[model samples]
Target chain A: MSNIFPEVANKVPRWILFGLTLKVLAIIAGLYYYFTPSYTRAGYQPVQPVSFDHSLHVKQVGLDCRYCHTFVDRSEHSTVPSSNTCMNCHSVVKADSDKLALVRESYQTGESIEWVKIHDTPDYVYFNHAVHVNRGVSCVHCHGQVDEMEEVYHAKSFTMNFCLDCHRNPEEFIRPVDKVYDLQWEPEDPEWEEQAQAFVHDWKVMPPESCSGCHR
Target chain B: MNRIITVVYIFLIILVVSVLGFRGSKSRKEPLYLFPDMDRQARYEPQGENPFFEDKMDDRLPPQNTIARGNALDRAGVFSSGFDATELTDVAFNTGRDEAGEFLKELPIEVNHELMELGRERYDIFCAVCHDETGDGNGAVKNFAPPTLSSANLLTQLYIDQSEGEIYNTISYGKNTMMGYADKLSPKERWAVVLYVRALQRAANATADDIPEAKRGELGL
Candidate 1:
């Protein structure tokens, strides 16, 4: 038979096969990196109606986390403070400032401020702020160094794996109950591991690893 | 052919990097959902938005004049009148006042070390920001506030002369330009704060003679 195929035909088939393999590999790599909560959820900084500065309130003013999040240790959900809580200080301190105009209006109108929420978990996952906080989990563990942030952002991935990592070994994360609100707190003792283990034992912090524990 | 393949690979890499960017990069855009699958249910969450309501709020305020359940007077033993429990006219524990609408001279709840400790914690969290740790009205907030809005000096003679219930009322309903903490502090917590405030007043006014004989040596009084 005459040379039915062109001289480049052999190279063309090989190149096409190589390109298909590379395409598949690229897709796998893309999904592996981009599908995670780390890429999708973390570092989400939303613009709030009023530019509330956490560093100013927490670092300078020296207010406790519970001062505004009063129900953190008492209720399932840690509530955002009402406009009245802002007016508590602003009414006297910066009463006429333009920055507090929205707060003043919300207080007078008895309307809820449209503050954007961060760190939202999936609907199926049931997370309780009081349960974790009461068990010596510091706010900084999940929320990061909010006392230093000028604008709050989602600091942690909050993936199921992230939660499970703590649940599996809570002794690695637990601190003194009194120091839960003290975000700057660190173990002064060199033998901090022993102290954490002791807390896990004494407090009976048996985090459920079963699916029903969280999904229910 | 080899050169063409190499160039295509490089282009593909640049495309991916430009589109996805780096992980955890700061972004103002909302998190993109690849597999939303029941991630956000239709059910209402606490403080969630609802288009159905005029206020666009899922959390509705309780109807007017409706007190939440489970707020009954359980700790009125300290100031219990001779009257029977059923016949008790005024719940002093909740109101911080007697049936005659007068502030109670003393706390209606029994004071103890536990309650005092709770008072210290709650006071530091809610009151010390403005009232100062020593009740001197010089707190972190005082540095920012005008002289007219300065927190009250709880150790002053004016405050010392006030009754416990009056102090409780102030903590609950607030006084002057101060906003009420009734929402933040429960009735028992308000009383605990009152006890702590009284202790602060006593400590501020104490003399060398007031120190206990055993503790005096510790302070070298």
Candidate 2:
């Protein structure tokens, strides 16, 4: 007991220990939020079997979203293009290209390519593409500028809070029905804010913010 | 001792800042979950194989005769007849062509204002994406150079004189690279779409006299 420990350590105040613990906790919280899939999945581009380039098809080729997602407006889920749909053009355009091997196989065998789903919500949450697309919500709103994306990824987190942020104030997102497919569409005019507000009223887009609205 | 405490504080600050800067980074590994809660719940994924069922396939077919909701044709007054030969004289609702193998000229349903409006709306939804809004065939997919419905040499005489039944057949069964709408659209809606296509053809090849005399001046016709 001849002062083996440093006298300074024994004399240390409890407040400093408390402060260090608080700092360590803050660091843990920061790391937790940073590592969540919502942040990491934003740029989570998966390698598709066909190596399909949305930029080439959508921007340069000018294909509409409905061309591949044929059932966006008619069905709750946006159906992926069937092999027949792919063969519509691939039968001639890139019929023998090495890159289109899977496309050819799928078309010939009548089997699906098994494209990986990037933007998946919790099984509890129900989402409808028809409701959003019909109400003038552009695909760009959630999917981002898909026309520019070489490979598509989840542009937005489909968390309850992220969804509620829009459902609460839909006027900020509403646009004309015709501009739904235009990725570059924006409120350019000075009165656009007022116009968007008017549109929300005119279309009667009252998205529910309650838990049952989506959970059910 | 004070220097050591300051060093610890600096290290903690650096750690927090570095973690915060990792936002939007891509990770191949799955995210850490505190509460799995319905996320990792036991359920069969689409096309998943399971040994629990006799078939061992998760994708089970619907019961022998139990139709899915909204799929019963009789309820919707939509019949899925391939050919209507009940009345040899009546060719309506028939997918078969006449003795000459030519498409029938008369539409099965009468054309009216309401039907035309409905046709236009449905046409915009289903056909306009590929057929183009003006039916000029300059649909958004021009890069692939899909066939146009408004080609003067193609649609003007060809589609215009092809007969309504032929066009209807094309819409129902699909022609060439175009996918058929028999599954997506009902029989009556298909007829309405045929009428709308005819209307588009007329508009595409319209002459000066085809317009109303009063509206001619406004259009500079």
Candidate 3:
């Protein structure tokens, strides 16, 4: 301790040392929030290539999400539709539009629309499209009432606890596959629906809820 | 110079003591391990309170480390799931049949004309590559040829020696050279393909006389 400074020989008062330590900590606290990223909405919402509307396709056109995003029930990704999927109607249906031009160019060049992904789990979270889809999760459960959205927002704040709550008690939040994807869907009668949801949700599926559930 | 020497001596002493202590701990100087009676090894420290609520382990741990006992360890939970072969068999046999068992009663399955069309598409992708489009055994696999899954011989044997669920079980988990559809087909698709397979078998056996003329092309004689 004496080696640190010549002043170390002096008997520093405990109060003076504690007060200086607190002042240093306060300055550090002031700088901390300044550097931290904004915690609102998972801190990432990069712009997508095209302004796509979920409500127009899902609610109005009555297109099931699985139509365009074909592999959701069978694979890892609820894959972005290929340009051809868009062009299936776009090429002939909207022949004059810029969206059609972009589609035509992608069809010719074989590059896809550069869509920035909005929904993302952390790298550690191991989610499967198959388990959720086949086991009665509707697409709307995580994706929100995407069919009703004008511009898709982060459907809900999909946090670890948010997912585990349903996973732990699957039937409560689980419903017919048709209604799974709705964020805005409240059960018609809160008490009756809550009881019904509880019946299935109470099945007590013991999911791996620790670090490895998502991490590995 | 003296201070530096003193500091270095203290560091060396710490390094030596730590190494010796680690080695001593590893050696287990108590030789009573061979005789369980002479040892305190049998004494069970409570494996800690609330074992269930604690974080689970890799599941690959040895018997000693495993907390699982009795009901929890009976079978892989996957086996109990609707997707598993055994569970699927039970559901297949119980549901989807009426009195005479002529055809499916009402299985809790969703039907999309698009998805069945998708079933037709994926059946072409996966099933046809083996079962052949005509439901015959002449698929284009280089050397291996699987049995005709669409044959009346296999399909018509109601209770088929093996239960219907057992057949579904076989399709899912696979048998002989057939790869299990567990990886390839979703549970719904697997069930759909089973229905589609039945349709193919019925078609394979159906003659022109059996069809009501109007729906013949759709049956594709």
Candidate 4:
């Protein structure tokens, strides 16, 4: 009875094995590339109740980040400005504009504007806005150049590794304390590296690499 | 066999490209979490919704007629040298008034170079948008604001004649069209702004004699 059929029969088994291997590799590659914070969370742009333009307020109008986010330097959570904060200017400026109808209503009714949050961390991560801003970590680092964004969107991956990149070497990112709010500020001096290192040392910006640092 | 393999490879490429698209492309949909893990928990986040409350707000306002606990004046004393234990009992620091219920003529906190610098920084952040960088009425908002909403020029004679405590009260509680910044600025910071405003007033009205003989040359006066 001997050797079954033709030599091509043996090759058919080999071809099927090769195809299986290719299919497995493709699936693994797809998962590795697509399932990451960069792909999933980086570009979330939720619609807010009001179309507040950051570029107009921050870049052109020259409002500081603290003008609206008043508690950023003092509290763990950065306070979203009350509608009263909006009315502080809008009540005088665009008092009758249809665009600001929601804002005017919120101010009058003493109701909170349901502004959708963009940059959110996992529940376990205890990130403090005060500690970062006070330690020379500019808002531009994590939030990106919000002064340029007309409608704010997530600009960076807030994954554990993304955070670790700065924590491991804060000298690469931290700027002068005075320049933290100035997003346009760039280190023009050739000795910026040395200056950043000095700031890291002086500020004692030893961000923890251990789990407890953020998790707890 | 070769033809079949080629077809399979092409199919895989199309599948990956179509499914993955491109990273960082804008999306209105919520992020899809594969594992989810504990990305969100059953805890109340700041500014989050709570159906348990009648207002459906997790953050509750402080009850009416309740003053914050602790020595509010004493807390401000930590930042300045002028306040003593005797002044802790006095409501002057918080209210910007004296025992006579009149705005104090001088700052409750001691004025120093550091306080002045802080004042300048805070004023630029909080006030310069409306009050202008040089304490002039013309600021970025002046273009949009009507005459009724125009910010007061701190350098004007009206502001110069005002007492330090009166200026502090204005900064804290706001005047006319301006809104109160009591929630935004601490008592110590309000005092610092008052000092900076006084400096601006003096600079605006300075005669050649007002400048120091040594510093006059710096200005090419």
Candidate 5:
């Protein structure tokens, strides 16, 4: 039998082929960026075991970030506070609330309540809380205004490029070492930027952009 | 040529459709790790259970008297006569109450400039959030127009009448909505905070006579 529609095969219009190729390229480019880890993980707010409201504790109650993250400035990892920290106030404040049963049980039994990690960095990337915090990076810079968050979520894409953006220009985000914990602090005046520059100068802050900076 | 074009077009369409149909975008699933190097390690995590230990806990307790590095002074026995009911004079640990269970009227630790400085620093970190920087109790926490320090709150005549030891007790075992700092602060630091609170009260309530002789001129007292 004759080849079905033989003329259509060899003499197909070049413009249609070009148009199809362009569409395929567009689809690939769109999906590639859309499905990137940064885009996919930007707002991954997992449902926590407890409905802990950061807004209630941090914003309304005006608790400092360090109140719960007790080791941010001293240790490599910023650990989640123990149940005892919650019981410190809950034992008296909301002593009988059913919502805090898990906290009470954990505190009493000396068992830990498993808090879901929000800002999870990959194992290959070594992130140190003390280094960043002690060097004048405020908690809000990377974590967003957690005080305003009703339920805490990962605020930034903790990707390599995201980290390198700040690591490359340390001065723009730097503040006075004392003001590092002031999550709400802003550049009050031109002098504030000047002060940050001075701090960067005085402390000799060099956020390394090398592979070993985080990879090690 | 036509068959080849059709095959290429179909392949591209299939790739695009499959990628687009991946899953619910809002689902909280992590992306698949194509090269998940060290993403999940075998190392023990903090507070994670371990069969190796008798208690099955990864966090091991220090072997009995392992005094934390900075807490060495906590065990120096600064108090000569505390809750033991002894009549010693040099004791700084008063347990913050009298026999009647009322707050003590005297501070066990001596109030000095160094102690006040330490107190100021610790207070700023721990108490300022709720108690505010000036200890007016108007800390941003309550958001309900908390009473100023000199008013009828914790710094007034009723509270001031209590001994410094009583204040220390209040710090150790928090009263009302305030959390106890026994875990967060050392005992000496608590006493220093008490002294600092007193100083804050004095500063807030100072009259012409309370000001120092030299600084009085600057204040136009």
Candidate 6:
């Protein structure tokens, strides 16, 4: 309080002043980019042929995504559930509703329901649900909080570099099956968790090591 | 004073970290063996010759089954056949007795109505799209082609008379264009479909006399 620097007059140096200004500018730029919600591939809220409430059907009703999107494990394209699957339940459940009308129309009309894929990655990037899920890649790692989404929306910034961040070190991002595609998913027990962590850290998994891991 | 304190703090940190790191490296790994007393302390130990370092320690260990008069741990895991660690088998660690033997020593899957019903449900859910409600390959996907399944001669030989294991194998590993239903159906469900296929075979070949009391009028057989 009373002239702390008694030996030398309290003075700010020129270089120190310049350094402070540069640090402040860097902090400002970093914060701006970090908080910005903008992305390269904008979210696709495309009006699907049937206004499918993924939340109502998948989450609320507990109708498994597998029940509708059957080919997730076996095939390249997780083929849109045929109208027949819809007709299985909707044949009785929502028979009067407009969703059922669209489904029935598809059956009578034999026209395919154009479902706008929510989590669409690039064509070159070969992503398999079976291998990724089986190997420990979380659904939320790619798909975001799908269970909560009323109409599906892209949750994560799906850039190649974004994927490469996880691909580089899979153990950092990948998790068990129950946590996959889940929002508030936590590992059930600590014993299983320790085992899971051991499995991940011990085994080597890298995209660069496995070309088909990404390419195929 | 701050500069001296910082330098002293850093020096202390470096010492602590070096100690911790050296100790940690050893703590992380199992010490395979102590270095052999160099057969008269040598001046230079090069590559494979240098023992008990991180990279070359694997070579320092004596070969499996080698007789050791003094050191006994060197011959550790000799009987394990090249593997230093004991392989953890699921069956051995799990209940000691044969697991399947305890559950269904004899496959208790008796020919029953419930199995047929389950088979029918699975067949309708999976196979009906390509192989119709009847065993005829005239499903919704068939586009009303020449009945691939209706031929009685083929149903008798290809499916009905074949061993249950063979039918199961066919369902597990698909044939031609038919995708394997292993992913879709469980092992029990696959067998169930095999049972349903057999039932369908019966329905196809049965004459009017074979029609049941309740369904005789319904089929007009």
The candidate that achieves the highest TM-score relative to the unseen native structure: 4
Ten residues in sequence with the least summed lDDT for candidate 6 chain A? A33-42
- DockQ for each numbered candidate: 0.81, 0.38, 0.02, 0.79, 0.28, 0.03
Which residue pairs collide, candidate 1? none
lDDT of 6 at A109: 70
Each candidate structure's TM-score, on Cα atoms with residue i matched to residue i, is 0.91, 0.79, 0.42, 0.93, 0.72, 0.43
How do the residues B54-155 of candidate 1 rate in per-residue lDDT, one tens digit apiece?
Answer: 998888887787744533455364345664443233479878889899999998887899889889999999999999999998989999998766789999
TM-score of 1: 0.91
Q: What does candidate 2's lDDT look like per residue over B1-221, in tens digits?
A: 66776688779778767764555555444444545588644676554546898756566788998987645544424433664433323445546366677777877766898888868867886677567778866655554553443212224576677888888888888777676777566677777888888888888888999989999999887
Candidate 3 Cα errors over 4 Å, as ranges:
A1-45, A169-171, A181-185, A189-204, B1-221
lDDT against the true structure, each candidate: 0.89, 0.72, 0.53, 0.87, 0.72, 0.55
Each prediction's fraction of true contacts recovered: 0.83, 0.28, 0.00, 0.76, 0.28, 0.00
**Model 2 TM-score (B-chain only):** 0.60
Tens-place lDDT per residue, model 6, A5-101, is: 6653334364456556755775575444332222322344545677777776554454445555565555555556656666644544445786567
lDDT assessment of candidate 3: 0.53
Q: Is the docking of candidate 5 incorrect, acceptable, medium or high quality?
A: acceptable
Model 2 spans > 4 angstroms off: A1-11, A21-25, A28-32, A35-37, B5-21, B28-34, B40-102, B109-153, B176-189
Minimum summed lDDT over a 10-residue window in model 5 chain A is located at A33-42
Docking class of 4: medium
RMSD of 6: 21.6
Superior by TM-score: candidate 2 or candidate 6? 2
Model 5: per-residue lDDT, tens digit, B58-174?
A: 878777978655344443365444343322322446366666666666666667889989898778777786667876766654444323321124456766566788778777887
**Residue-by-residue lDDT tens digits, candidate 2, A1-216:** 588778677656665787778777876877677656566556666777778898988766566787678778877788777677766666655567899888889778755677777776667778898999999888988888889878776777655677888899998888888788889897789998898898889889999988799988
- The CAPRI-style docking tier of model 3 reads incorrect
User: For residues A40-119, what per-residue lDDT tens digits would candidate 4 score against the true structure?
Assistant: 88899988889999999986679999999988988899889988899888878989999999999988887778899999
